[model samples]
Target: MERPQNMSIAPRIAVGVIILFHAVGLVGLSLPATRPLFLQVVPWHLLLMLLTIVFGHYKLSGRFKAFILVVFWLGFFAEWIGVHKGWLFGNYAYGTTLGVKMFDIPLMIGVNWFLLVYSAGVTMQRSGLKNGFVRVVTGAGLLVLLDVLIEPVAIKFNYWQWIAGSIPLKNYACWFLVGAVMLYVFELFNFKKQGIAAPALLITEFVFFGALNLVIGLWPL
Candidate 1:
C-alpha cells in the first residue's frame, strides 16, 4: 500500500500531544489558591521563541539577520536597564516573574522578552505584513493584542507584583511603542519577509500553550 506524500502522522501526533499537555496545565490553574502562583512560573513567553526556531523562521538574509540579532540584544539590554533603573515598568520589583537575578534583573526574564519581541517581528512578516505604514501599524497592533491576553494573566499570577494595583495604561503604551518601533526596524531591514513559516510556528504555539493553559484551568494548580 502506498501512503500519500502529504499525509504524515508525526506532526499530527506531536501537535496533539502538545495541545493535551497545555490543556492539562490550564485545568490545574483554576484553583483559587493555585491560580495566581500557577500563572507566574509558567514559561509561556519562551514558547514564542521556540515556535520561531522549530519552524525554521530564524533564517533570514544576511543583512536582515544581523539586524534582528542587534534588535534582540538591544531588547535584552533595555529590559535589564528598565528593571534595574526603574525607568519603565515601575518600582514593583521581581520575584517569581524574574526567577533569578543577574545585574539586578532576571536573566531569563530579559531573554524571554527579547525572544518574544523577535517572535513578534517574525510573525508579523509571516502575516504578509511589510515595511509600510499599514503593515507596520497592523503588526504593532497584533503585538499589543497579544499583550492584552498576557497582562491580566501576568498580574493575576503575580508576575510583576504591581505595587499600586492594576497595570497602568502608560505601561501598556510603552509596550506598544517598543514593539512597534522594533518591528519597524525589522521591516526596514527587510527581515519581515522571512516570515513565510510563521503560520506553522503560531499553530505550534497555539496548540501547545493554548491547550496547556486550558487544561491548567487558566488559574493556578
Candidate 2:
C-alpha cells in the first residue's frame, strides 16, 4: 500500500520543528555552561515517536503498527532493567534530560526507546530484504551502529555519565538483541504490507536533530 493521497502538512511541520529544536540543542551544548540545558531537551528519540505516529496516520498495516509499538516497548523495558542492574548501556545515571525518575529510569527514557525502536523496525521492514532472519539481524545491527556514534557524544555532554571509562560492548550487544527481538516480534505480528511511511518520517528526524544541533551551535543555549 502506498501512502494515502491526502496526507496533512501538520505532521511534517511538527517533525520539522522538533528537528529544529534538536539542532539548536546541539549548538547549545557546545557552550561550557549552557551545554547542560541543551542536553536536557534533546530527547533524540521523541522525533522517532512522531515519525511512528506519522507512519500510523499514513495507514501502516495494523500488524506493522503493533510491531513498532511492541518492539519499542521491549527496548524500553530492557533499558530500564539494564540500567538499574548495571548490565545494559552501562551504569550511567540519567540527568534532567528525562526529568525525575524511579529505579534510575526516567519515564521519558522509555518513551524514547519506543520511538527509536519503532522507527528502526519500520526502516528495516522497508529495506527490500528477502530473508526475515537477515532483516531482523541487520536491522538490530544498524541500530547498534548508530549507537556507536550516539553514545560518546551523549556521554561527553553529560546527558548521562558512565561510571566506567567507556561504554562496554555488552551494552551495545544487548541493544542489538532487543532490536532483533523487536523485529522478529514485528514479523510474527504480520507486517507483510508494503507501506509504513518511514522514509519521510526518519528523514524528518535526521533533519530535525541535525538542525537542532546546528542552532544550538549558533545560539549556544
Candidate 3:
C-alpha cells in the first residue's frame, strides 16, 4: 500500500498551473487589448503544458524518452509536409502568433501536438477501455471534436489560416487520422496510470477552447 506521505505533489502543482494559465489565457484572449499579448504567450503556454505532462510522468526511462522524441519530430515533420506539400491537414498556413518559424512552421507546433496527443492518450488510457483500437479511435474522436471548437478560435486569433478562408472536411479527417496514429504510439508504451494531470489538461483544453468559442460567438472579439 502506498502512503500519502510518499505521494508526489508534482501532479497537483502541474494541474494547478494548467488551470490557472488556461483560465488567464481564455480571458486574456477574449478581450481586445489583451489578445495580442496573450497570443504571444501561446507558445510558452504550450511549452508549460509539455513540461507539466513530462513532470507528471516522473520516471523518464529510455523508451519514454524515445516516445517524446518520436512524437516531437514526427509531429514537426508532419506539419512541415502539411504546410509545404499540403498533404496532411489540408492547405492551412500558420500565423506569426505562435512564434518563430522553421520552414514556416512554428517549432512549438510539435509541442502542441505532443501535448494534445499525450493528454488524449492518457485520458483514454484511464477511461477503463480494454482494447487498443477503441482507445485510439475514441481519443482521436475527442481531439476532432476539440478541433471543431478550436478552428474558429484559432482563425480569429491567427494561430493558422485556412486556405481561401475556408476550412475543409479534409482537415478534420486528417486530424482524426494523425491523432489516432499518435495515440497508437502512446498505447505501445507502458506508463504508470497514476496521474490526473494529463486528464486535467485534456479537460482544460476542451474548456479553454469551448469557452472561448462561446465567448467569441457572443462578443465577436
Candidate 4:
C-alpha cells in the first residue's frame, strides 16, 4: 500500500503531546527549583522520544525492523568502543543523568542514534532529493549539525563529559562518518516514509537543543 502524504490524526496528536510535554519539561529544567526533578525524568523522556519514533514506523516491513536493529547495535558498539577505547567519538564518557547503562554506555545512546539517522533520512527523502548519494550525505550532515547543538547541552546537563573541557573535533568527524553509513543503509533498505513523527521529532529536538545551547551558552567552554 502507498503511504499517506499527510500523517493521520492519531500519530499527529501523539507527536503534539510529546512536543508539549518536552517543551514544558525544558522550561522546568531552566529553573533551579525544578531542575532536580527534571533531571530525574530525563531517562523517561528519552524513552518516550524513542517510543514516538517507533510509533511513527508502526506496521513497517521487516526490512525496516532489521535496519533499526543494525543501526541500534552499531551505534551501541561504536559508543562502547568510544567510551572504553576512546576511538570513534573521542575520549568522552556518559554521565548518570541519562540513567541506566550497559558497558558504560547509556542504552538510550543507541536508540538516539537510530532515531537521528531515521529521522534525518526520512527528512531527506521528503525533501524531494532523488539521488541516493546526495540524500545520504545530506542526511548525515544534518545529523552532525544536530550533534553540534546537542554536545554543549549534553555537557551542561551532565549527560556526558569530554576529556579536555571541550568537545573534540574527532567526535564530530565520527558522527559524520557513522551517520553517513547509517543513512546509506537506510537508503539501501528502502523503508517507506510515513507520518509526521519523524520530521516533527527531528525538528523538535533541533529546536529544543538549539534553544538550550543558545540560552546556556556552552558551559565550561
Candidate 5:
C-alpha cells in the first residue's frame, strides 16, 4: 500500500498515537517500576496498533482483506511448525507476556506477523523501488534487521526463549526466508494508496525495539 496523498485527520491521529504509545512503551518497559504493567498489556497494545492501522484508512478492498487472512494463517502456521518442530523460526517457546496461545503458540503471533508484514509491505510499496521481487527481498531484509533488534530484548522480556540458550544463525536465516515468502505473496496483490499508519507502525516498532536493545545492553549478559 502507498501513503495516501492529502491524508485526512485520521492518519495524522494514528501517527500521533503510534509515536505516543512507543514513547510511553519505551519509558514503561525500560523502567523497573512500570515494566510489569506494560509487559502485561503487550497484547492489548498490539491490538490497539492494529486498530489504529485499520481504522486510520478507508474500508479495505476485497483483495486486501483476503490478503490479510492469508498472511495471518501463514504466520501462525509457520510459527506452529517452528514451535512444534523447530523448523521455521527456531526452537523457541513463548512466554505469557504475549498472551493466549493456540496449539502452544500465541494467537497474537499471527497478528504480529500480519502487522509487521503489512507495515513492511506498505513501507516498501511507497518506496521508489520499481521491481516487485526486489521490493520483496528488501522488505524481507528489513524484517531481518528489525528482528536483530528485537531478538535479545524479546528473549530478555520472556516473549520467547531459545531452546539452546542462544540464538542460532539459522533463526535469522529462516526469518529472512519466511519473511520473503510472505512478502512475495504481498507483492502478488495490488493494493491502493492507503494511509501513513502502516509505515508509521513499522518505524515505531524499529524505534521501540531498537531502544530496548540499547537499554538492555547495559545489563550484564
Candidate 6:
C-alpha cells in the first residue's frame, strides 16, 4: 500500500533546521574554545533532534503510535536497570553531560533509543528486504554499527562512563538483543513509509558521531 501524501512544509523546515544545527555543532565542537560550550548544550540538541523526528513523522497510525510508546518505555526501563543493577548494558553510569536524570538514567537516553531504532527500522524497510527476519537482523545490526561510533564520542563528552575505562562486550550484546526486539515490533506494525526524514536523520546522526569519533580519536586533545 502506498503511503498517504501527507508531506508538508513542516518536515522540510525541520530538516533544514537540523542540518543548520549540526553544521554549527560540527564547527563549534572542532574548536577547543567552543567545544565546552557546545557540549553543555548537547541535551538541547538531542531534544531538537527528537522533535524533528516527531514533526517529520507526525501522521503516524495508531499502531505506530503504540509502537513508539512501547519502544520508549522498553528503552527507558533497560537503561534504568542497567544503571542501578549493572545488568543490561554492563556497568555504566550516566554523567552530567546529558542533562537531567531520573533515578540516574538520562531521559534523553530513551529518546535517543527510539530515534535510532525507528530510523533504522524505516531504513531497512526501504532496503527492499522482503523477509521479516532479515530486516530485523539488518536493522538491529545498523543500530549496533551506529553505537560503535557513538560509544567513544559519548564517553569523551561524558554522556556516560564505563567501568575499567572500556566498554564491555556485554553492552553490545544487549544492544543487539534489545534492538532486534524493537525492530521486530516495528516490522509487525508494517508502517507506511513516512518520507526521507528517517533516512536523513539516521545519516545525519551517523555522520555527526562518526566525525566526532574520528576527530577525537586522532587528536585526543
Best by TM-score: 3
* Separate clash counts for every candidate: 22, 12, 0, 0, 0, 0
Rank by lDDT, descending?
A: 5, 3, 6, 4, 2, 1
Which stretches in model 3 have alpha-carbon errors above 4 Å? 1-9
Worst ten in a row by lDDT for model 3: 1-10
What's the true lDDT of residue 114 in model 5?
Answer: 91
- The 10-residue segment of model 1 with minimum total lDDT is 1-10
Positional deviation of 79 in candidate 6, in angstroms?
0.8
lDDT per residue, candidate 1, 1-221, as tens digits? 23224322334443444455445555556556665565555655345344434334333346745764666566666666666775765555555654666665655664555455555666666665434666667666666666666655556555566667767776667677777777677667764244233344344444444444554454343
Off by over 4 Å in 5: 1-9, 219-221
Mind sharing the TM-score for model 3? 0.94
Is candidate 3 or 6 superior in lDDT? Answer: 3
Cα lDDT tens digits, model 6, 1-221, are: 23336643365676677778888998888789999999899889888887777767747557766877888888999999898998898998899998889888888888888888989988888888889999999889888888999999888888999977899989999999999998998888878766667777888888988898888978895
Model 4 per-residue lDDT tens digits across residues 1-221: 33443323357666786699779887877776888899888888878877767756746566767888999998999899898998888998899888889989988888888889988988887888889999998888889999999998889888999987888899999999999998988888887656667877889888988877766864332
Q: Against the true structure, what is every candidate's RMSD? A: 5.9, 4.6, 2.0, 2.9, 2.4, 2.3
Candidates 3 and 4: which is better by TM-score? 3
Local distance difference test values of all predictions, in order? 0.55, 0.61, 0.86, 0.82, 0.87, 0.84
For residue 1, what is the lDDT in candidate 6?
A: 27
Worst 10 contiguous positions by lDDT, candidate 6: 1-10
* Sort order, TM-score high to low: 3, 5, 6, 4, 2, 1
